[model samples]
Target: MPDPMKVIETHWNSTPVPIDAIIRDIGLPLSYEPMADNISGYIERTDGSYRIVVNSLHPETRQRFTAAHELGHYIYHRDLLGDGVGDNRAYRTEGTNRPNANIRPIHERQANSFAANVLMPRHRLTDVTDESTAALAVRFNVSQQAMAIRLGRAG
Candidate 1:
């Protein structure tokens, strides 16, 4: 199996802020335009560049998560898997899917985990005041569910 940590380390080293730096470092301005009917996000890697197409129709938080998730695919899994990586084809469960289901397919799960970790690294989220998921979410700019998962994984 490929080392997921190495993938994350590579992305971390290549980026200064990891999330936003990936855009500016490659000279791509962040555009939050609604993609046509089909496109979710796109990265033009020909010149080692990126252009993410987000659906402004969605909630701001949803779009932010999508952008971060797409960024995870770009940083960690794109070259390894080749083209068309920005397509969010992998399954995401609402409530019934087992928690592990969120992290089964190796690449997709890793990308999700990478996005979560990059956006909310341990060093940044170490405040750990009282263990409330909602509190942590406010601290990290992530969803309450994401904070809960990270806290669970940390233990």
Candidate 2:
């Protein structure tokens, strides 16, 4: 598979970052559905094709994050994935809440990091000065919390 970061770099021409295009460019099909409240999304390989499903009920911005996160899994954890990964409300898989692993699985952590990078790329954020998180989130079409997390990570 092509490097996820490379894919992002290739397709990331805007804030909110053409997420669906990036996912599709990586060769995965995308869909949205209403899911249980705590369920954000999941990625599964059925038959021969890979697919990413996001909760339609979630906010659109959040869904973009979720999709990017699943893309992260497709990139970093394909071998470890036995079937698929279901992310919970906090964007973590079940049984990944162990504090020792920083309260999330390494895969989950990596995916989350990847999602942040996809949405609010470090190169973009580094060019800004004195912008508020809320403003940046709006510009990036991501949640304030997510933007704050990305900013923190960038620093």
Candidate 3:
């Protein structure tokens, strides 16, 4: 099995790891668009470009995770084969909410794991335990929920 921290670190240093840069790197146009209720974000493959459409409806934390999750799809899941051969699985668009949806069991888990690691890489999260979720949320420009999730996973 691969070390999750190592995988996140590798991606962080080598590519456009910053959020905006990652958005551009994936050929998505940077824009501030309002998202409807219950909609966190959406990913579209259009004109040979992958666009991540974020719904500014919820708190910032939700948007951050949504972006990272979409990026997870872009990075890890898109290239895998779908024949149940090797480690591949079918793609589902029901969203990555494990409690609500019944998408491909493994892929959703992988994407969530990827999102958690990418959004709050482990090294940076080491000292985060000293801070409250709100403090860490402010520091990361994400939500309290996201901060809690990251903290839980990192620890």
Candidate 4:
């Protein structure tokens, strides 16, 4: 698998981090469809490659976060994926589907961190010390909460 940080760095020419381009570079196919209200998205290895499916009903920011989170599993916890990482609306990985993967909460936190890093690369923020969290979130195309968490982490 490609080093995700390197991938993000190479493709960080724009705001929002252009995750679709990253997905293409990672060779993971993506799709969006309506799903249960409780579900956010999932990433699975089908045949020999990874696939990301996002909830069509979710907000674009959420879909972006979901895709990034799944990429998180692909990067940090590939060996832990029995089937794949399925996340719920609260950003926690969980499922009752038969053959569900036994992923731990630590991985969930890692993935969340990965998503935040991907969406809000810290290097991009170094030049700015006057932006509000909401403004930064808008500039980065992430939720204010996500940016707040990121800024908190950065501090």
Could you give candidate 3's per-residue lDDT for residues 1-155 as a string of tens digits? Answer: 24433445555753224665555654556454574464555555556545566666666666666667666655665554221111111124443222223235576577677776777666777765567878766766766666677677434
Lowest lDDT sum, 10 consecutive residues, model 2, at 95-104
lDDT (Cα, tens digit) per residue for candidate 4, span 106-143: 88888888887788887888866687888888988888
TM-score of each: 0.61, 0.86, 0.65, 0.89
Where does candidate 1 have its weakest 10-residue lDDT segment? Answer: 93-102
* Residue 122 error, candidate 1, Å: 0.9
lDDT of 2 at 70: 86
Candidate 1 Cα lDDT to native: 0.54
Per candidate, the number of residue pairs that clash is 0, 0, 2, 0
Ranking by TM-score: 4, 2, 3, 1
lDDT tens digits by residue: candidate 1, 1-155 = 23434544555633222545454444445566665433444443444554555656665544556666766666675555333344432323222112222233676687677667776676655667666777667655666766778778434
Per-residue lDDT of model 2, residues 1-155, tens digit only? 67666887887767568999999887788999988888898888777757899989999889999999988888887776656778887887763221222224777888988888888877788866688887888999999888877777444
Pick the TM-score winner. Answer: 4
lDDT of each: 0.54, 0.80, 0.56, 0.81
Q: Give the distance in Å from residue 8's predicted Cα in candidate 4 to where it truly belongs.
A: 1.8
Candidate 1 regions with alpha-carbon error over 4 angstroms: 1-18, 35-48, 89-104, 127-131, 153-155
Tell me how far the alpha carbon of residue 63 in candidate 2 is from the true structure, in angstroms, after superposition.
0.4
CA shift of 103, model 2, Å? 13
Model 3 lDDT on a 0 to 1 scale: 0.56
All predictions: root-mean-square deviation over Cα?
7.7, 4.1, 7.6, 2.4
